[model samples]
Target: MTTRPARRTRRTGPALQAAGIGAAALLALTACSSSGDSPSAPGASSGDSSAKLGGTVTVFAAASLTESFTALGKEFEREHPGTKVTFNFGGSDTLAASITGGAPADVFAAASPTTMDVVTGRNETATAPTTFVRNRLEIATLPGNPGKVASLKDLTAPDLKVVLCDETVPCGSAARKALDASHLKLTPVSYEQDVKSALTKVELKEADAAVVYQTDVKAAGDKVEGVEFPEAAGAVNDYPIALLKDAPNTAAAKAFIALVRSPAGQKVLTAAGFLEPAS
Candidate 1:
């Protein structure tokens, strides 16, 4: 009695290969669909991540930027929460010298491109400096016209006690340009190192008048009076700012620079009498 061999039910060569290929095709399809649904890196946002910026940013800025930049600094700190902004406000040239001389600073904002050139020439900036605003000269005089000063020529009155910025500074250089444009020779009773010091002379009544930036007079409020002169148009100083190459707070420094260039910053600067820089 020969019993027929049980029919083999096992999958042979081609059938096994076909099944394996089908399994692989399913996995490839699964992988392709999952790839399009991956999540983004955590904490990513439209703006720079706040977590990336938390440190003290030391800013060396021109005296003329004191009020506006200080306001912006407060806003910056408020926006950044844990970040702190410190400032050293003085003449652009003085600030540049300090930075070039190894002062620990994160950013530099100069009242003139020439002063900024001092830093850029030394390759101290992380990036090329950008002009943020333009400022024209204005004569800051004692309130109520105590000196009866009205024009740039009046600053030349022999009886008038006038103070100007040191010729090496931006304000002084602009003053010189304005004077040269008007073809008028006027000497100051003193040459202050920065626009603020020159404005301070008039504010404190130490001098009868000062040739300074319109923004300075505006920042001083009623402490001084502003007088516009036509020659100021020819000597408008372009303010430039940059992030330092060796900034202690590189992230915070870059954020501060962005704030200064924002519309909010332009509002503060313009409200302080600074002219909008050309696009």
Candidate 2:
């Protein structure tokens, strides 16, 4: 036997073709599995998943939320790198007006639900609002109780330089309710445009007393002394927050909201003397 008749030559063409086909099949399968357009693909970007979390967000918040929100803003930026938060803090009514007038804003935090309703009615809100905190009126006086303004009834005492928030603002409305509940008539020296302005009058000694949120007095610290009165129970103000309908950065807005609702955010708010929202 011709030992090995001539070494049979093995044809490599079919084997090579089969290997090529197998490689092509693997490529096609990979393309299908990784299709970015597929709804079930975890890497697909869509809905809340697609919302990229880095962008500038402009927030218009009530003056009462200034300190707490500012702190929270810093924390948010730290947690979400590449994000920036710009804030406009003032009276809720004024902030609402700015939003309705077409000012570019990503979020709004109002001192009162009524004011929030105003902004929502203007079609400026993108999402359902949530109450984040509650605040109550307090009598702010100069350090050392110089005025001796002891009670809501004392505020009506003649010659006391008492300042109140403008009636259009949340604090002013709450003041009215408190006064009505106490059956006391108050003739303030001035109707401040915002709560901080009212508190500032007390801090500067321009006014002996002012009706402001308890949080404001806490923020003022030694600048002013806070006196809690019984009538405040009747006039608690609720703080509400929501994303704006025309927000330039919706992802940032939602993230900011999440931060505010987070435990860390609550700590900041509570440290500033805001009460937790009712359960």
Off by over 4 Å in 2: 1-52
lDDT of 2 by residue, 90-208 (tens): 99999999889999999999999999999899888998888988998888887877667667887888978899999999999999998998778889999999999999998788999
Cα TM-score of candidate 1: 0.82
What range of 10 consecutive residues in model 2 has the weakest lDDT sum? 1-10
* lDDT (CA) per prediction: 0.78, 0.78
Error of 1 at 185 (Å): 1.2
Error of 1 at 207 (Å): 1.0
How many backbone collisions does model 2 have?
0
